[model samples]
Target chain A: MTRVETQDRRQQAPRRSLTRRLWRAAPPGLRQPLGLVAALVAAAWLVICLIGPVIAPHDPLAQELPRFTPPGEIAFLGTDELGRDLLSRILAGARVTIGLSLLLVCLSMLIGSVLGLLAGFFGRWVDETIMRFTDLVLAFPTVILAMVTAAALGASLFNAVLAALVVSWPPYARVVRSIVLGLRGNDFVFSGRLLGFSAARSIRVDILPNTLGPTLVLASLDIGTAALLLSGLSFLGLGAKPPTPEWGSMVSAAVSHFDKWWLGVFPGLAILTVVMSFNFIGDALRDALDPGVERR
Target chain B: MSGRAPVIAARDLEVTYPGHPPVHAVRGVSFELFRGEVVGLVGESGCGKSTIAKVLTGLVRPAAGEVEYHGRPVRPLGVGRRPLAQTGIQMVFQDPGSSLNPRRPVGAQIQDGLDLAAKRARRSGRRSGAGPVGEPPADPANVRRVIGQPADAAVSPTAARLLPAGSPGRWLERVGLEAADQSRYPRSFSGGQRQRIATARALAAEPDVLIGDEPISALDASTQAKVAYLMSRLALSQGAVLLFISHDLSVVRLIADRLLVMWAGRIVESGPTEAVWSNPGHPYTKVLLGAIPAPDGAGRLPLVPPSAAAFDAPPVIHAP
Candidate 1:
């Protein structure tokens, strides 16, 4: 058979097999209810974030009503201190907050995984150099590092994401490096070398696949932390400047008007919902991905 | 058999693991492997039998000396750009479970070897200006000579094209696995089946020299016999030189043409398998042979003392 046919056959086989395995491995009883609820909530949140701007009734920034208006017919969640729709602002903010967090997580995972694979595969000097650098980055608390990076780069939505990416990648690298260190000595890797695979090819084929599951679990868990950090940075005036309608920025705007519960409550709930959903999903993924865990 | 050129030859190979004291794994070990010949390297655990196999297959680099393929010194661990020499050596590891990537299907793992073989074929074909057919290329340069004319003047282009379409399935079948079983992951298979898959993978490379580092040690007696029989048959069919490393004398005796008895990192005895079985020379070889329990439940065999003299002195008996 030609290469294309072989690839086609393999592709066809895996899709069916994967679905079957996943169906068979689905969580049962209380775990199932917990996992299903978490998955649904996370999925719902992502959908809302994706379509929030399209469906929002009022212009998030429009000052159409009197400032600090209570929930009524025109605006379901009431108006903010600026007389802007709290509901619309929260809806608009979802896109920026969630999207930036996702991007940061992906970028960090990519950078971290590659460096870790290299360090783990080629031990001794290569391992030491990369790990020492990772240790340096990890020495500082994550938020402090993000704060310093944001401060250095100048605060904005993009700069906050960049800072988070810079600060978060070291953990992924450390996790992947440890995983690779354990797997490099496996007989499959040795066989790969004996089969004339180059070091890079062996790492890509043998090491990378094994590292992905754990890294994915890490990525999911970190997304919540990243979202929280990004929101915290914006609350501190280091991210998504005024009139941008970011969740954290909205909460920051509501702080002085302590009696205007609508301004803080809705946006706070949005952040809480998103972060909790991610944590749930991450927990489920950790259990699912572990081979030692009994799926049934 | 006597006149046949050795496919691979090691000269005074030494491998040491760097540490506080440094492990002297294999010391001054030398052996020659010929086409279609199965040479068993047997010793008790930690005697460096596996290390010798690793050295021969280029998995472990020797601290001193070199491994020559067709009279040329190839890199000990497939580290260099010499694709021709690299493709010629392949190894099956001892642990079947760990020898396969858990995430990948067994078939895909087998295809890795096939892919390497195909690449090697394409490269050699392009270099020789012959389209991977007819007689093998005659250029001494193409033979990857280290210092002299290669005993085998040409590498068989057939070796490269050995894995055609559906060849992994064919190899799996040859190793007593189902064709459809290739689609399954390594974790899905039993230890014996996984070993068979690993064997299939090694055979798929169509290597000139195939090394089995305690390949059957992990299997039960029945599976061991079956896999050993399959390996010997496959090696003969492919005309590949087989380096069967094991501490199990019975298994080696069943498969090997010649035997190299290792004792504390040195080959203490070397001879035809039957001859050595009949009249073992070297104290270590005698001890190894005596250690094999008699099948008829007879009285205990006499215990041979570990020879300290062999450690300090050169081998006293060299078999012809």
Candidate 2:
């Protein structure tokens, strides 16, 4: 084969996602392995979510009709306060929790990434002004910070998402800003400008694509945290109301029947299973994407 | 050189980055880079030289006219997306250390690209290392014989089926490094040493063309000569096309067989290195030749503003 063809053959061998293709193309020094893996894990989580609802065994919300029963027949994790199947409720709840968490994270990343790109690319007094504003928000204790937002907006799934996003986006914005600071001065970015990537497209293509390697991992890890925060809000009666089958609200209802321990145990277990698995996936992804990072 | 195919042939190219009415960085640049022959691109800071470098490599899109590789409109001036011809071309960036992920180890970093290429041949069922993008090492004995090494020895690849052609250690020494330095990160090495490592890494891939965008620009003056010497050594040793880009005229003069000059996205002058240096015709060409500071600083002069006539005059075109 001609040398280029040989090389082409070699490169053609590896089928990859857009992220992997982009990462592989970067010089060895620029590859941040842990960050890539984390992002991949997040993407995998989304994939898992896509096929999950169909495979869930029993209806996640099918009531057992026998109240306070422990792991037994007709119900996997036993019954809740209304004699509902715990496993059923937990399985069904994964759809909304995973779906909404993704939505909130996506919206947050979009808003934060764009703002960061604007702040970073324009740099000047504009950068300073936006940076200070993010800092002001950052100064607030995050949980308490999200609380005030939830209160002002009034509690609901969508509103909680908005509140969480307001709290979450600053970190993404900060990360993207720093990255843009480095990228904004690069030859490629300058080349993009010269090539007519335009100020916006340059940031969108040259800058934004690079930022995702890190930002996405953070967003993935943040999903589990965001879910927890939303759950915690619900536990405090700031989330979805009864019969909504929300994990946090179910946990909240379990409080009234403390003597019936299965109610609290099952919901808490559901939260733990989803959160822990996501955390593991995040860690694995960080490892895989950053094959370069020296594993600790 | 003229008979050989011109992989990259450009005529009167211009580049303007968007800004206040757009800053015209490179104007009327033109040249032909032959297949298997290295063309040296040189100019001072903000002269639109680097812009031209990116234009050819497909990393930077050009704003006007044609940048053809093998008669294919690889990256037409103002092409919206990267084209196939451009995709075949790859770039070895300025800072090798910074170009890599800070947190990753060097082995995997190298392995990452190798792995990606290997994965592509999944249907071919070729194992990762000894495929088309890479070659089996030449016999270890050959490397030892070339460098007269006593420091180390290993199994020769002369009879091997899949490894690259030579011993990795001797190759390191060939690139002006000790075998021990192979295991060390680029950070532990000096600026010159790091550059040498980058050159070695680029050499490892055995690419069709190597575009060194000021590969030695980041090194100190004292170290530049050796690094330059090592690059020439590797290029001759491997016979890969070397397109050395630098702003240092003195440096470009030492290594280039053919010299291509770019000013504000246009080629003001180009010819055999000796020809362009001795008999520069274009005004910009004369400016560049005269711009070179003479020994004892006698020939040194400040940049004179280009007269309005120089600005308005159509760019000079030098087609092969």
Candidate 3:
């Protein structure tokens, strides 16, 4: 009987490994085509942000082209009124526009989720203090609050990011807090407490892992919004002062010469593509993380 | 059971949930559990069986009562800071599906009990002379041992019989679970298998008082008997006091050494299992026993008639 069981196990082993190997070797794109395309687009922007200066065909700041050149001029996407290449300027702007938005979103998410977890888990006074502060911050429109803070701190990119960070965190705190409150009364958490786990230990070991998927989906969704808000800040002259290649400031510069058209359209298209890609990635992430939702 | 102090004793327990009309969940209920015996507390829904379990485990504080472990009163001391004595009273909740954390591997959940046990042993200085804390003791039983074995070691000959393969497999195999499946999540297993995992976790603590609040009712008819038998047998072998709470009298009778029947937040009857089964003293006990359908298909069991008002009222308290 033992020999027969061993023979049966040996027969099953190779078949399992072969299927797993085949699955692993298949490209991720083949399984979820839309997600793959979105990921590729997002990855291309990140690569461009890193190597923008090296790959630009012309010096972004150097005035070497005819003034207000339209598309198909010596400059690929034509030139700004000051005659700088629009393609090169857009390329260099990707770093400040995309990079700063990602950094601010990450910072806000970290701050918000921690406060939320503590408030939901500890309750009573801890809940009261954190939630009241969150409520106060959330009372104002986020843009108005961010604009005021950025203006107060002087119209610069750093201050704009800091301003956005201040307003962005309250939503995350609210989301994480609600999730933790729901799980607080779950049986597994009670079981953890029965086994002599401290509140901190229970939050870390039992509750935190369950909350991660939802929080990640929320974070992905927020990336596009963060970029838009930062661009809005720059457009208002509260971020990315001139001489710095920022897409929002570049578009703002185009507004004076509305007839020039190419100046506004190209930079607008760059923002659109990046934002759309992130939104798609967020949709894919939500589908992947939520077990209740069917994958399309 | 005589001449030895009870492992756990409850005195005049009362629980009331405040509202427009206060709900008195458990009123003037008391019981004592001796080590190495399965004492079944049988009742229908909302008869305070779960409340009693909660009061004993210190999840809910009783309005007026004290829970004594080995004759000394132990109060609830918040989470993670539970007194070493109170840590020995572990509970297995009814819904096996929710009792185990869905995200965690079953092995880590089992290991939680083991790690806490080791920590308790270290703090109490019980292992000072045993050897290094990490080293396995020379006696294989000690390596797998729970705290404070009952005076009669020979009482659980069935402990050896239950797990013949030896101690290395630990608590998982003893409860009829695969030790190899320890790393898998709770969603991977069926309801019966999850119940087995829950039982394994409760027993891994080597608890002195193991409370099963409707532990097997959620399982299918076939798996119910197997899980119930496994739970009682394993708890008894560890020299633990098994408080098997269930609505199903049939499953309870098969494993319990003694029986306590509850009605309207009070126990109406108490005695040895066979005595209560054969000649129940209380009308409520009689009604409960009669409610169990006999498989011979002789006749349908009578439902509780409106005329049976005596069965709904609380019976006179009897000290056991």
Candidate 4:
């Protein structure tokens, strides 16, 4: 039956074809102008987070300008009551606020998704143990539980993240568990088992890929909420310590200087833009990953 | 007949699913499949056809009786161990579209069978601490190197097509597809082509018994015959016992050498395909035969009156 079949002669694609394919398959919501703009803004913030301190105009901690200087050549966004450059402080805070949020989301999603896959696939006692724990965590109001955990862990950025992570992962477990429950019944998964694949192999190779879209959509939507919660903890002084340039602490510090409106307004605007941009991106992801959308 | 032990034997099998009231899915079903024979298991909906397929492949443990492969009792699947029956008996599922992993290329999906076979060989080789007589040599220390060996040089010719690096493309060709098509995803293939890929994957493992449970049910009428023909032909050519299960009698009649008719979780009639078609001994079989719509319009459609007696009657066994 051997023929001199010429080996696959299909022209090699450009090296970045994988990237192109991902771009093509991206949800229509992400491709739309609103989603694109939101993505651009989010990308800009992420860049600022990575290299914020270096690019910031002045020493964020330096009270060099005179107190309460209005927007001028000397102080662009104006100086806070402490005479620190508001632009420099907001720029420096972006790293702690956004980076911590992304970290919390990733950690929670990883822990929760793995637990959900195990609970859904193994189901009997495993399901009971995981779901009951998830319920216990979910029963508490999210911010309150995070606040209590943060307070208990002491005042610091790292402990705040740990508290947020503890509260945030339950929703992921619930969502991923339901998705896995539906997918575990698919014939491909059963066929994998029939083909002598181990339970772990079947779950990873056959079932995991199917759950990615929904899980990803959920993760994207949670980024902004994660940021807000972390900021909230910091605002309560149970998070970042004084002079750390965290947005929530900056806003809290401004309360003492109520007459200086710019003290409150700049950091507030920073939080709003970051949160709104993430929300827009999350909405687009949900639309893109919707089953009714043409993924091909 | 070969006068040898049956490849797969199910003796008085019963499967009861637990629910509010227990559903006796398969009640005292028995059958034997011989090498190189195509057996058609025909039945109406809800007659426990799929349940029997599951039982035979050891997916669902029968509450009573046993499934024996080559006279050895097939063990129930235990945690962390490969299913004993899986190495010898592979199944082609109902829906071709869903039977394949949509995210993977057809080539990698086919490669799974070959890789599994290599893994099984390595396991046995290690247990025996040497290559058993007439078995493939213990896989090279590097499995990838063994897979890269030429198909004919890798193992026995019977298993050559299952070499992970060597024969995915060849197996695709055996199922009437281009070797180049292996890289394509399941969605790109038509229903018939996907079923053929399913057949190729199952056959690649060099199983002794192949169970196709309504393998063409999701396909169009035109594609159904082609896929059904391809399956029986390829399975026979490989000398595997092909237990072809389906509800449509016409397709079964075209390929099956022997026929087993099932009703309400029991095999009601058994005989050669032609013998059962010509002279159905059971009333239920007659009703089933009559229900097939005659496209030429020569005979009127037969109406089946509700009869408890027909369902409960003893099975009619016919000599081959």
* Best candidate (score: TM-score): 4
Counting clashing residue pairs in each candidate, in order, gives 2, 48, 0, 0
Q: Which is better, 3 or 4, measured by DockQ?
A: 3
In candidate 2, what are the lDDT values of residues A1-296, reduced to their tens digit? 58989898678767767877776765443355544454455455465467644655555555646777777776668777677777767766666677777787788788888889889988888789999999999999888878788888888877777888878888888988998899766644543333233466666656776787778767766778877887877787666656767788888898998887878887787677666656655555555456377522
Interface CA RMSD of each prediction in angstroms: 2.0, 7.2, 1.6, 1.7
User: Please, what are the lDDT tens digits per residue for candidate 4 over residues A93-168?
Assistant: 9999999999999999999999899888888899999999999999999999999999899989999999999999
Better of 2 and 3 by lDDT: 3
What candidate 2 gets wrong by more than 4 Å, as runs, is: A1-166, A177-181, A184-296, B75-88, B95-97, B112-174, B178-183, B294-320
Better of 1 and 4 by DockQ: 4
Give candidate 1 regions above 4 Å deviation: A1-30, A70-74, B78-82, B126-166, B294-320
**lDDT tens readout by residue for model 4, B1-320:** 54777889999999999997999989999988887788999998889999999888777889999999888887776445456445768999998768888888998888878776666667666322121212222432101111222322312234333423336887777676777788999989988888888888887776768999999888887777677766776666556789999999987887788899999999999988889999999988988888888888577867574399887777988788
Whole-structure CA lDDT of model 4: 0.82
* Residues forming the 10-long window of minimal summed lDDT in candidate 4 chain A: A1-10
Error of 4 at B198 (Å): 1.6
CAPRI quality level assigned to candidate 1 from its DockQ score? acceptable
Ranking by lDDT: 4, 3, 1, 2
lDDT of each: 0.79, 0.63, 0.80, 0.82
If you superpose only chain B onto the true chain B, what TM-score does each candidate give? 0.83, 0.72, 0.83, 0.84
Recovered native contacts, candidate 1: 0.67
TM-score of each predicted structure versus truth: 0.86, 0.52, 0.86, 0.88
- lDDT for each residue of candidate 3 in B7-48, tens digit (9 for 90 to 100): 999999998989979889888888888876788999889989
Instruction: List each candidate's DockQ score.
Output: 0.45, 0.04, 0.55, 0.51
